[model samples]
Target chain A: MSQGEPGIELDTSLGYMLKAAASALHSAMEAVLSPLGMTITHYSCLELLAQRPGLSNSELARGAFVTRQSMNVLLQSLERQGLVIRPARAPVGRALPTELTDLGRRQLEVASAAVRRVEQNMLADLDTDEQDQMRRLLRTCITSITEPPASTT
Target chain B: MSQGEPGIELDTSLGYMLKAAASALHSAMEAVLSPLGMTITHYSCLELLAQRPGLSNSELARGAFVTRQSMNVLLQSLERQGLVIRPARAPVGRALPTELTDLGRRQLEVASAAVRRVEQNMLADLDTDEQDQMRRLLRTCITSITEPPASTT
Candidate 1:
């Protein structure tokens, strides 16, 4: 029972449920991905490159939902590991476009398959219509929160 | 455009959409809570105690979706700040049931209102029926991922 003021009705709060669902998914991903020595952000960067081929560090940071500083550190590590490549000097401006190396692509194959299985399991109970509905609803929530609040100033 | 194998369909993947929604909500909450000098988990721990008083550190960790060691450190910090209390020694077992102080309750009032606003913003576009649908869909996802990988030899 909620005692008094300052109480969030966690049982019915959609945000709370969203967090719970995300936390569960995170745990499941870690369970599989950790064995590969890859973090969610690591796999995310590789996946972004696999799709986009020449994403900038800022772009990858945005896609991975991490800070640019952290993304830079990861990019450097990945580069040192021969999993990704970037020109020593920016081809244009100060942005160095990054792409996955062949080694990175090969590594992604195994990790990506493992991740796909987790996603599949997460949707195992939802039918086609339900899954589509979920995507639409989740996008709505994302937009609603991410949008700038109506000018109260 | 997706290059080839190992690339996740970012636009259509329900899992990706879920992460996007959760990330937006997280940013919104942090925007508000940080000004209140609380992290999401810090607010979450106090909120949990507000709703369910006398929860052990481990129980709080599970509810907050953090490791017990991390929760223990947070609990110690909260105790030092006079926001929460635990017996010097366990009243029964190794578990220390945690309770909020009056100061904690006061602190939660401000943070809880901010969090509620964020949650409401996230659901602003959804009517009651659609909100319920999102809840049901998310719960299904949580269960699917959290349950064991159906008895592989």
Candidate 2:
């Protein structure tokens, strides 16, 4: 369909492509991780906490690119599963720092393998170079989109 | 951290990058489309139905990459909103076809503009060639990941 005029019709826009690829990968990951009683969001939260122990709730929310409210809900779910523990002492103006417990660590280990297997299948078609390129480009785009705008005088 | 090495290291993996980009875009699109009272899932269903006017329920599910069960739920919501209509007669073995109403078409027009604006802002940093390359690479990867494997001897 034309936008009020005739054109080549770029149906494969970057947004469409990104959404399609992500959706496909996400669906596959969900299928693989669901039996473990986790969603991609759940696995991501564990992955973040595993990598950065003692991150405040807000910090974790920022890293996860979700609203603080949403992150809190996820934290509650994780805490219930014994995958994470929040400290008693609260930060000055933020929620208390949270860390993974031994049980959480073990769960992370299992989840990591499941996730890596899914990633391998997803990237199987691409050789090393293409995979690297894909990662680099996506990283650049993510950074660009997430960055604050520069001052325009 | 090396493989099998533990404790809080940057993931810096392709899966992480892909997931982050997708999450960011999803959040951005959600914010933009929220004023219209539509989720990305809703917008996607409407778009597919718009392009293919007479799609059956299962076909719509496949086109939208959602399970039939989920599609049924979404269809119910859309039906409640009066944006979609389904015929009463059930064909031989197939469910009745679904199509968008006039209100759905108008809503889609508005949503399309909002989507395009957000997409433009998201891709502002990349040049045309880079955009093309990103789309091509993502398309290739998705096709590879979603395709059925060839039979092995």
Candidate 3:
């Protein structure tokens, strides 16, 4: 209960700041993406596909940080909208590789520009070196959490 | 569509890395919080109350980065469980200032300990200086995203 002990000071905690940054980024992305008839996850899916075509549903889900089941539903809707296509069967394993249609690509082009602007704007204050440092620090945090806990005797 | 131009490199994008770090932190917190019979947002609500005891529902919503509607639902549930209380009617304006009960404070003690461990584990690799740098950089990113976009010609 003491302020200096286990009590988390929301102002100075790196974890809280990280979440706040992410939340701000998420909100900014959504504000732009929503006007384009897409959610942040939806834009993420298209961006993933644009960068790496012929990705499976599960891979896309992982790339977009969403559940496969939810991505499956989204993919189905995209398929019906003629924005993407999947063969009737998986030509390889049980994983169907997905590709964006020409229309999807066109739509993504516009969305990508808007998103790029958002990201670039967010880094407006930080210089190139600072941006790199931020990335490294963030990656370290990710590793620390994902790795096993230190010995707790 | 060309690499090095408009195409975002997923492997190195700062935004993507930020999301990854947040996701990792979220999973770690959930792992610890779940066993304690709580979710991340639930723990966040209690923690916010512990630190600032009279946060209103809308204020908590903003602090926790959830919608007011969702936070209201959660608040009602917490009140029912006798973890928090709000006056029968708003003593000041329509906003009811919320306070944690003694039981709420007790539950938060356990949850806070668990969360602190997760946070400490996540910062194990970073030195003291780097942690401060991270906080500054993250606050910058948050500010960048929240501020209005620079004028584009």
What is the lDDT of every predicted structure here? Answer: 0.89, 0.76, 0.87
Scored against the true structure, residue B33 in model 2 reaches a CA lDDT of 89
The candidate scoring highest on TM-score is 1
Best by lDDT: 1
The sequence of per-residue lDDT tens digits that candidate 3 reaches over residues B17-77 is 9998998899889988998888888999999999887789998998899999999999999
lDDT of 2 by residue, B40-108 (tens): 888878887777676777877765677888999999889888999998787555577888999989999
Minimal lDDT window, size 10, model 3 chain A: A1-10
Task: List clashing residue pairs in candidate 2.
Answer: A51-B8
**For model 1, what is the error of residue B106's alpha carbon versus the real structure, in angstroms, after optimal superposition?**
0.6
> Which ten residues in a row are the worst by lDDT in model 1 chain B?
B1-10
**Tens-digit lDDT string for candidate 1 (A12-106):** 78888999999999888888899999999999999989988889999999998899999999999999999999999998998999988999999
Going through the candidates in order, what fraction of the true interface contacts does each contain?
A: 0.83, 0.52, 0.73
Per-candidate clashes come to 0, 1, 0
Give me the iRMSD of candidate 1, please. 3.3
lDDT of 2 at B151: 29
Q: In angstroms, how far off is B76's CA in candidate 3?
A: 0.2
Interface RMSD for each predicted structure: 3.3, 4.8, 4.3
Model 1 regions more than 4 Å off: A1-8, A151-153, B1-4, B151-153
Off by over 4 Å in 2: A1-11, A147-153, B1-11, B148-153
